[model samples]
Structures are given as structure tokens and as C-alpha cells.
Target: MKNMNIQVKGTIAPGYGVASGKGGDSRFPQGTIEMQKPFFQELGLDLSPYFSGTLNISIHPHRYRVKSFKYTFINVKWSSIQPAEDFSFADCRILFNDSSFEGLIYYPHPDTKPDHFQAADILEVIAPKIDGLKYGDELILECDRTQIDIVIVKKFWKY
Candidate 1:
């Protein structure tokens, strides 16, 4: 377990809305939760300790290394209630100003994801909800570099 500090700066933004039930696939949240249950269970992780939904951040011009790993693919089967889907996740520590939270970064299989989510600058972070944060706010996230196997994938553009 090699630990390296990774720092990311970005502005808060609204995502697909599926996590908050505002729009998109209505069953997405439930399906994601269900799909993640067993994986977390196997790790002896308690889901009850965290909040549901993700914090979307948009980073433009700025580039940060993306860490990768051998992740388990979660198959969310479609039932009479919802559509089928696949999801993947990686664990990381999120640094927000003076606060820090342990969380997962979810990556939905490309075939099953919305176009807007495929942006290189957009990141979906799931953690216990943080208060006093709003859209357009700048934030910094620090995590172990090995967790995501990150490498700089883009060049920084001047605004």
C-alpha cells in the first residue's frame, strides 16, 4: 500500500442529478446503493456511516494525475423496478478546506453513463455530506496517489 499525497483543485458543480433524485435515471441511486452493498460488506465497511449521493466538481484548464487500480465491477441487474447497469469505484481521502472525509470515487461504465459525465474535468466524489459548501466554490482534495494510480492526462490552460 504505497501512500502518496495528491492535491486537486476544482469548482463545485451540479452533476447528473441522479444521486439527489432531482432528475436522470430515477432508479440510479437505489441501484447504485444496492450494487455497492455487497462489495462494501465484503470489506467490512459500514455504509450507514456515510451519506448517500456525490459531490460533483468541475476542473477546467487544471490537470491532475488520475490514479487507477484493479477495481471490481459491480453489476446492477435490471428488475421490474429499474434498468440494469455496471459501476466501478476506488477509495480516497477528500480534503475540503479544514475538513477531511473518507470516500469513494465512482466511475460508471462508459456505455451506461451520460455524456456530460464523461468530461475529463468532471469528478464525482461520494462521501459523508459536507456542510457550508456551495456550487462554484473552489475546493482542494488530497488523497493517496496510489489509490487511483493517477498521472497527468491533460495540459493546464490559462483562463
Candidate 2:
């Protein structure tokens, strides 16, 4: 069966500085994505067109689980000081103010990820540089249902 398209509203949120290396994260002085590019390129995935940093999008009340993936690189020893980690990507689109940009959902498996864990509501996106985009900006995120399953988490109130 063909994949279904799912659209959810999300807000851009600040992320851990390790992805861009702007923050003083000693583990990734050059940024995690920047250091991993060469390894990804060697694995036949060139991330040159996209920005080195990730866009942290928050979809509150909703969380996602990977049903499948478009690309998955296993045990990539990108950093000399850190152990190898696995990464996955899925086709995605970011829509804002009548403009839509193609991107990939960047998923670095937490099992192998050493530090900087993200909340379930945050979706890390890797796309070409987006101008005039800032934190707290509302955006529409589109993904394939077959590749990602978005679900709502109900809250319980204490009596």
C-alpha cells in the first residue's frame, strides 16, 4: 500500500547546541552534524544541500514513532572521541507562511546517542537554511504515515 501523508502543527523550539556547535558542548566542538557529514557522505548520503544544524519543532500533545525509514546509517564512527552511533532519515516537508520546503526528519537513535536527549514532542528536522525563521514560530510539518506514526497523548488530571 502507498504511504499516507500526515500533517501536524508544530512550533519551532530551541534545541541543544551540539547540532550547530554554537553552544559550548565540549563533546561536539565542531557540531555533531558537521562532524558526521563526511561519514554520511561515505555512506552515499551527501548532506551538503541541507544546513548543518537541526530545526527543533515541538508538537505538543503529539508524539511520533518511526514506522519505517527512508535511510538508515548504522554504527557511524563520525567522532574520534565518541563511540559510533546510528542515524535515520525520513522524507518530510516544512510549511510556513505559504512556503513549503522539503526536508528530512533527522533521527539519531537515542540508544546509541551519548548525551543531549530530546523530549518525545520534539522533532529534529534537517533542511536547507530557512530565512526569517525563529523560535516559537508556528509551522506545519508533513510526513509519511507509513514512515512515521503520530499519536496524541492524553493527559490525566488529578482529582
Candidate 3:
């Protein structure tokens, strides 16, 4: 695949924190994990290699669109715990504070996601927990340009 690096700045924000939940007790993290299990397995990935929850980052001014040559949508089935949903992801490397981690930029289908998660400037990233990070802190996100398309909707805005 063609490779290029794209960088952007974002600030930490509070999220549903459902990925930190165990099993099907919680809605998002648990449900996402269960739903994505089959898809990952099909790709020869381990059943559960990601953190249970996600980190919310508000990317100011600019919004990103991902276009991958080899991309697929993940369909999450409805169960006793939650409703069915569809989402897409792009692999990325996140740089926060002084640490970096490999992660995925998760974009839930607009119609399928909760209202709170529909912000255009917000990004949901799944990665191992980063210590000493808290809400309102700024960080940098670098990803493969081939996998993501960025469009600056507004020139300046504060969060």
C-alpha cells in the first residue's frame, strides 16, 4: 500500500468510557468488542488485542475523512445488551505527551452512533491507556495519509 504520514493536533476529552467495562455489562466498549471479534478473527487478528475502551479527542477546526485502499466496515450485531451498529476504522500512530502507541481511528456510522459522538471535530481512538493523560490536554496524532483524508471545514475554532 502507498504510504504517507499525516499529522494533526487534538485535545483530550471525556468519553462514554464503555470500552473499559467488562463483558457485555457495558454498552459501547463491551458491545464494540463483541461485535468486532468475528471481523478481527477473520483477518487473523487475535480475538481481543485492544483496550476495552476508547479515548476521545476533539480535533479543532479540521475534520478527517478516511479513504483506505483496503478498507472494510465492521457491522456490530445487536444483542441483549445493545443495538446493532456499523463502523469503520483506520490504522494510526498516536503521539500524546511523551509517549506514542499504535491505534485505530474509529468512526462509527453517523446514523448508527449516539448523538454525543456525532461531533465533526471529535475523533474516537482506540489504544492502550496512556498514563498521566487527562481531559483538556493537547496531543498530536500521526497517521498514514493514504488511509485518511483531511478537510479543513473551518479556519479557527476553540473547544
Candidate 4:
């Protein structure tokens, strides 16, 4: 067997909130940050063939391209929710669909690697507002996990 070293250069596609208000964005003392409140949504973890495993399978330096998968949530009147009525909600994050989202790149692939890593090549939306908003009714979404094809250079660094 050969050494499995998968170098995943992952990224998290930026996402926008879908809510009944006037969208999300805020200007702070420094600059600005987009704030969004989605009406609601339901997302399930699905990893089929072509890329299915325990996230610990052996591979040599692999990079995965992740796109922002969106799923429609609740549909309010768009007038009920106030733009800045202080819904007492948390915040979220944004990312790209390429080698941008640095937080989602799990090198060893397993959460239980021999060397505990503080970082991984995995993309995710942090602390999204998807709990007690008004998300309900029907839902529709399209998602996929494609392998990021890139040239790998295996050169000796030290003698």
C-alpha cells in the first residue's frame, strides 16, 4: 500500500440569508458585515458513491471544490419580520466555492487523527440563524460534492 496524503484545498461558497425582512448587512465602527435572517430550512447530510466513505479513506493530496448549496426554508409575508427589530439572533459566515474557505480543509480526513489538528479542509456555514425563525412549509434544494482536480507537486523539501 502507498502513503495516503490527501491535501484538500477546500472552500466554502458564500451564502445569503433568505428571510421575510429586508435582508442582512451591518456597518460597524471598523467597516461592515452582512447580516441575514433566513425564514427557515432543512438540510440533511448526503454522501453517495463517487465520494462516499468514512471521511478517512486513503488518498494522496486531494482538493475538494465546494459550492454554496442552498435550500429554501419558510416563506413569511416579508412584512411581518422587521429589518432591524432585534430578533435576538446570532451571526453567520461566508466563503467561496474554491480554495478560499480555509476552515474546512481536513488534511488527515478523520476527526480522530493521530496528530490532533486544529484545522481541516472542510467548508461550513458557522452559527446560521435556522432555529426559531419562521421557517416552514415546502423546501427545495440542489447539492453536490465534486473533487477539485489540481496538479500536485511532490518534491523533497529537506534532505
Give the winner by lDDT.
2
Per-residue lDDT of 1-159 in model 2, one digit per residue for the tens? 235789999999999888999888988888999998889899988899999989999999899989999999999998889889999999899999899888989999999999889999999999999999999999999998889988999989999
lDDT agreement with native, every candidate: 0.63, 0.91, 0.69, 0.23
> Total backbone clashes of model 2?
0
TM-score ranking, best first: 2, 3, 1, 4
Which one wins on TM-score? 2
lDDT of 4 by residue, 30-88 (tens): 11111222222112212111111111211224323333223222222223223322111
Query: Which residue pairs in candidate 3 collide?
Result: 19-52, 19-53
Model 1, range 66-106, lDDT digits (tens) per residue?
45643545555534454455566667666677887887776
What are the runs in model 1 whose C-alpha is more than 4 Å off?
24-46, 63-67, 78-83, 114-116, 149-159
Task: Give residue 155's error in model 1 in angstroms.
Answer: 6.4
Per-residue lDDT value at 63 in model 2 = 98
Where does candidate 4 stray beyond 4 Å?
1-41, 44-53, 61-147, 156-159
> Candidate 2 — which pairs collide?
none
lDDT of 2: 0.91
